[model samples]
Target chain A: MDHPITVDSDACTRCGICIEICPMGIIAQDGPDDLPGLVPGGAAVCSRCGHCEAVCPAGAVSARYPACGPQHLPGGSAAIAPADLAAYLRARRTVRRYREECVDRETVEALLDVVRFAPSGMNGQPVHWLVVHDPAEVRRLAGLAIAWMREASRAGHPMADLFGVLVRTWDAGVDQICRGAPHLVIAHADAKNPMAYTDSIIALTWLEVAAPSFGLGTCWAGFFQMAASASPALAEALGLPEGHAPQYAMALGYPAYRFPRVPGREPVRVTWR
Target chain B: MDHPITVDSDACTRCGICIEICPMGIIAQDGPDDLPGLVPGGAAVCSRCGHCEAVCPAGAVSARYPACGPQHLPGGSAAIAPADLAAYLRARRTVRRYREECVDRETVEALLDVVRFAPSGMNGQPVHWLVVHDPAEVRRLAGLAIAWMREASRAGHPMADLFGVLVRTWDAGVDQICRGAPHLVIAHADAKNPMAYTDSIIALTWLEVAAPSFGLGTCWAGFFQMAASASPALAEALGLPEGHAPQYAMALGYPAYRFPRVPGREPVRVTWR
Candidate 1:
């Protein structure tokens, strides 16, 4: 069924571009008596290529792709390719333990190559990344983060439940959740710029998505990021610029465990209006 | 080619979770001398379901699906499938003009629904939204933005070239880009919160990815967002809370122009450690 590109008649300036650009010759003038409308009745068979979508200058048209969901990407491989998207999101777990092997610099670089393209607000492009490969340095940073979490937990902060789990794991002599992944990639951005964190996280998410493809595990290390903000010594050691602040950190490594089934979780709350 | 869940031996602490959870009988202790290595010649194929990822309390394991990129649940459809991660990244573009139709409330809600789940620093969840629906109000706000841009342009701001083009377009009887959209969604967070902008932006990116699938066009209206920040009257009208600051605004509608090819850009710089 073809749905005519719906436009607010009052808002339409008769740009006519929509009619000219429709790949399917379905859009046309409604004649002098009729307002501009689509031909072949109300339903227009749309290829869903989004050519009309990319061309409508008035920002008026809305196409409904019944099969498309909120996560669809226009012009990408699939707006919602089932295998890749599901596996990408489900595959990322907050990995904390690791084997002792070192991750080569080449692999880390390859991951960054993909992440470097993350969109920035106004293309401000304020985000920067720091890769820490020294094992000792990683441990030192992890120790500082653990110390912060321990103090917060002891002080009974509202997030103590999460921090408490971490402290207990640390006390149990389990490897640090960061698992001492030989490298720590820290994303930083201009603290004064409002969009820094968004840029950093987008890049980080890209890295997360790309990590599993490379057989590397990643755990978001918020504590380390916060530590960079809260402690000058940590920030200095990370070589952060004067106005730069760390937004997120990922501890990357290979997993030491495997489970057969997808883990259960509280269903995410999503309301369609 | 079954790899034994290669672990960074220096990074691992001999945690027994791998042995405890290996569904396949591939994992075993390599004698007391060889710190818990997986069998050298095992043919175990990782299901890559991320069960170990979820259960890895230490946050050490990372699994990458080579073909998939980041996965997200869009508007709560069954898990969105993944596509070629590289292809998806390559295909993303910055859309500007839009059509003349109004975006449905359901579409906006769906986008918000998906983006609302963006992780906040410490789960603060402090971000707020102001969805502008009134066409008249949208025009009024856009006029103010145009006024601001004109002033800045005359003052020879570095963006004068861009503003000149926008002004020229408006003078040529085309609707201002900011006013061209049927909906304006503004993201705000507490001004005092250093991470507010970052939080807002991550949420915005979520919306951006999810919008096109529903046949909606989105443009980053950073200048308008900035104008709102500068104009207290406008901010108050938008119902920004006393302490909250508007960080981003997006123009959403149908697209105005179509390009036959994805735009190419210079490669971004990325270095491996």
Candidate 2:
């Protein structure tokens, strides 16, 4: 296969940074001023991580695999200090109670735009997003999940006890399903990709970590995901792409309360090797 | 069952924030002077998120679940803006080439200290860390992984072809297994925990994202992990606690070079419901 890379001869200063930075050591040049090219069989083995395109000083190299090429990263005083970021991450609360306000479209777009940077296996980036924006629609889909749990409980599923509790809680007019949040975000991917599960979860974690900075909160929508996987009707309601399966979901909204301090955790269990 | 929470009445201001914020709606007060208490059967359904203890005004509420208590978060001018953080996350590189220097114990401890805050299912927080501090030890482990691949290739294992490439790469003086990284950070958890895999990956992603801030770099140790799971000797060498299995590993070290820009990715794919 031909190398999925292009070098702009006019713009190229031939710095050879791309040759040095490629993780697979695929790119090579015969001399300092020579234009770098992929070594024999390098195209087939390339992980498509784009380090070459990213490190190029003269905007000379481009990886065709990513399709989007390199991005213009915003920098300067806006950079976060390690201590401050640690504090921010620690102070994050799993918001279940939400104000009766909708997160605007632009803000959600911005959040996804940032989350697109989350890493993937060989940079395959197989994950996709399904956003349920309307709170009422979120509730409607959640009600379908409750119906699934009701059936599963009656059918003596192994998790019937848990399902029964969820069904009973729903009957009590309490939303134990989607947590009454204004929005629901689902990560989905092709069922066949081995890395799909890991990559999607990583991307969602990035989303969860970054949301608080935008004055938002998230709760893992475990019930919804389990139901979406088991119930055809719920999956139909999600309207995900043809081949994608729902991996997980998160409830999102403006938090009803602000957490003042970071709660503690179990003493970290570690064994240094 | 008695509630697992303890409240100090003398310190309690009766502000009722805990009652308002408990995700399970378990905490309650009967009167203006009454201290908050958990409703009957609340302990079983608490979810152990600790919002009550974290939100308390006078530090009066304490959850019995978390071994550690509330932490004083460093706030104010240190907090990062959304744009800056986006820049930081996007600009991160998976470092393969590393400077041959050991990261001091204090810095590694500080990084783990911050990483402990990564969220988990129902706040179970089951993930554990195994840090391989010595470079020679890391090389030894990598050699074991290569040995596993070499044997697998000879034995005609299903993944033998892939292992053949890795073994050949190692023989060619390219340390493809561990990439010559000085430290190997492994996240492990009880093999029985259903959420262990997801939670550990989330926590390690947090480590990878947070590392760049400390002038460190990380590359996912996929080859090493594949071998560790298949090679009992490598797993024994890790010396993880009983009942725990390695979920994932990452190679960590000071980067040999810095990339100037963020590589691009596929356009974000989404479906709005």
**Global lDDT scores for all candidate models:** 0.60, 0.85
Q: Against the true two-chain complex, what DockQ does each candidate achieve?
A: 0.09, 0.65
Point to the candidate with the largest DockQ.
Answer: 2
* Deviation from native of the Cα of residue A17 in model 1, angstroms: 10
| Per-prediction interface RMSD in Å | 10.6, 2.0
Write candidate 2's Cα lDDT for A1-273 as tens digits: 566788888888887778767877888888887878888898898887888888787878877874555775554532567787778777877887888899998899889988988988877889899899989999999999999999988998999998998888888988878888999999999989989999988999899888987888999888888899999999888888888899899999998887767777766666666
- Chain B TM-score against the true chain B, each candidate: 0.64, 0.91
Best candidate (score: TM-score): 2
lDDT of 2 at A127: 88
**Angstrom error at residue B5, model 1:** 32
Off by over 4 Å in 1: A1-78, A81-107, A121-128, A133-137, A143-182, A188-198, A209-219, A229-248, A254-273, B1-83, B147-179, B192-194, B258-260, B265-268, B271-273
